[model samples]
Each structure stands twice: as structure tokens, then as C-alpha cells.
Target chain A: DAGVTQSPTHLIKTRGQQVTLRCSPKSGHDTVSWYQQALGQGPQFIFQYYEEEERQRGNFPDRFSGHQFPNYSSELNVNALLLGDSALYLCASSLVYDTQYFGPGTRLTVL
Target chain B: DQQVKQNSPSLSVQEGRISILNCDYTNSMFDYFLWYKKYPAEGPTFLISISSIKDKNEDGRFTVFLNKSAKHLSLHIVPSQPGDSAVYFCAVFVQGAQKLVFGQGTRLTINP
Candidate 1:
């Protein structure tokens, strides 16, 4: 019954630095999706991973990418971050076509 | 352009009164709609969802109404509680797509 869990509740990085965020989905869920929520904004989908492959993506740039492990855990990697990249990174999990359950989110502050 | 929009940035309601949050989408292709409640520093929690084929769906104190013709959706919370005060987001998806298009979110405050 454990819901989606994400690591590193908050982090600070300088511009041009690379950062990695991790997520472990809720038990019994398969699909994993990543989202970015700017201050006072709703989450914008980054991409979705199913069967270890990225099945869908959003309007984000190539600098943002992710990986899903065999255990259904996910990692979001951002390369050469910019100041605009500062936001709360959320991880959501769901069964195929089911409602997504979101984690607490990692607050990334790019200076 | 924002496909989904929640025009109201904030709303206040008295406890035990009805609270209505509105959302509108410009896409006619959206077939499913959902409402999510989120507290500060936490991710959104699913509140209610309605399919395009249905006009209304109710669960406990929450009811979601959809007007496909107008491309609008609404979430009603009856007998609102203080615990229900949070930012509410309206999300939409197409029939076959897994990605959701979300509104800007409305902050609801239920006063005691």
C-alpha cells in the first residue's frame, strides 16, 4: 500500500550542473511518468515510461531524460541545467490506463 | 496555448457550504476528465473523474460535471470541510492517450 516515493526531498545545484532524481512507484503499479511543476503551476508532463521504454513525451527539451528499471523504479536526469529548470519534479505511477498516483516531489533549485 | 484552463486563481467557501471549481478545455478530442486536490508541498491527490460519455459522476461529497458541448467541466464539493482546502486541478486526456493535460489549478479555501 506504499504510494509513490521519491528521493532527495530538495537539492541545490549551479547552472550547467547535472542532477539526477530517483523514484520508486507504488506497489502493484507498472507505468511511470515524470512531471515538472513550476511555482504556482500545475504539473506539466515530461514523459511516460512503459515496459522499460519511453512510450510518450512532452514539449521538454533533449536535456531532460529518464530511465525505468526492471523493478519499476525511475530516474530523471537533467543535463546542463538552467535557472529556469528550478521547479518541483514530481513522479507519478499507475497501472496501464489507470489513474496516476503522484509522489511528494523533489524540489530542485538551480542557481 | 493552454488546452485546459482554470480561470479562478482562488476561491473561499464556508464550511458545510457548497464549493464549485470550474475548468474549461479548448480541445474537443478530450474524452476523459479528472479533478485532483493538492496540499502545499505535496503532489496532487485524485478527487473525482468523469468520462466524456457521462454528464456527471459523484463520489461521496465530490461530484464532477462535464459539459462536452461547451468544453467545460466543474467539481463540486458539498458540505465542504476545512481539510478539503487545497489547490484543485482539472486534468483531461484523450481516449487512447496516457498523458494528461492539466489546468493551472484553483486554490480552494474552506473556512471554519
Candidate 2:
């Protein structure tokens, strides 16, 4: 009955550091998608995971990557972070693809 | 290039009035469209959606109208309430693609 859940509601990291954010999909959901929302902007798609494999990716750079576990939980990893990397990272879960239920998101601030 | 666009950054409407948020897309391949509402410090929540085959879909006070020919869609909230104030985003799903393209969101303010 629980919706999508994300860990480390807020985080602060320095430039060039790596950070991993976690997400647990809603019950009965098999697909997980990651998105980034900068201040005053809409959420941008990063990638999507299904069947424990990445199925689709957005225009993001190689620094942004993600993984989906067998339990349908997901992790978004960002390496060599820059100041522009500071934003709200949102995780969404769905049965298929388009219809998504989102989590509260993890706010990452890169200094 | 931004495929999805919500040109109006903000909109203000009086309580009990109607609020119409508009969105446009440049891609004709988009088959499914959705609207999401978000509050500060929180992720977006699904509001309403429409597929390419349909021109309109409604849920209570919220209605989404799609004009495929124009590659445009609009969300209308009738008798808007103060609680309706939030940032609304328009999203498009490309056929056969699992990813969604999002617009720059419109901040709606319902004044009482």
C-alpha cells in the first residue's frame, strides 16, 4: 500500500564527489524511472529500469546512471558531481511506463 | 531542444474561477500526455492524462483536452480553489519509448 519511497531526503556533497540515492517502488510496480528537477524547472528524465535492467535513458551525461534491484527498488548514482548537479532527484514507479507515481524525492546539493 | 513546452511560467486565478493551463509539444510522435501537480519540497503527483486517440478526459474538477492536430493540450480546473495552487507540469510519452518528455511547468496560484 505504500507509495514510492526515497532515502536521504537531503544531502550535501562537494564537487567531484560521488553520491547514491535510493528508492523503493510502490507495491505491485515493476518499472522505476529517475528524474532530476532543478529549481524553478520541471522534472527531466534521467533513465528507466525494468526487469533489473536499464530499458531507456534520457539525454543526460554518462555521469548519471542507475540500477534496479530484483525487489524493484532502485539507486541513482552520480559521479564527478558539479554545482549544476544540485537539484531534487525524483523516483517514480509504475506498472508499465507512462503512468507513474512519484516519491518525495531526495534533494542533493553539490557545493 | 525542448520538445515539451509550457510557455506561461505562472498563472493567477480567483477562487471559484476557472484555471486553464496550456502546453505544447513539437513532436508528433507523442501518443500519451499527462499532467502532474507538485508542491514545494515534494515530488510531483499525477493529476490527469489523455491518450492520442481521445480528445478529452475529465476527473471531477480537472479536465484535460488534447488537440493532436495542433500538438497542444490544456488542463482546465473549474471552480478552482485555493488549495489548487501548485506547480503543474505537462509530460508526453513517445510511442514505444519508456521515457517521458516534460515541460518547464506552470505555477498556478488560486487566490481566495
The candidate maximizing DockQ is 2
Model-by-model lDDT, in order?
0.93, 0.93
Off by over 4 Å in 1: B95-97
lDDT tens digits by residue: candidate 1, B20-109: 999999989888999999999898898889999999999999999999999999999999999999999999865455788889999999
lDDT of 2 by residue, B45-89 (tens): 999999999999999999999999999999999989999999999
In candidate 2, residue B12 scores what lDDT?
100
How high is the TM-score of chain A in model 2?
0.98
CAPRI verdict on model 2?
Answer: medium
lDDT of 1 by residue, A59-79 (tens): 999999999999999999999
What's the DockQ for every one of the candidates?
0.77, 0.79
Each model's interface RMSD (Å)?
1.1, 1.2
User: lDDT value for candidate 1?
Assistant: 0.93
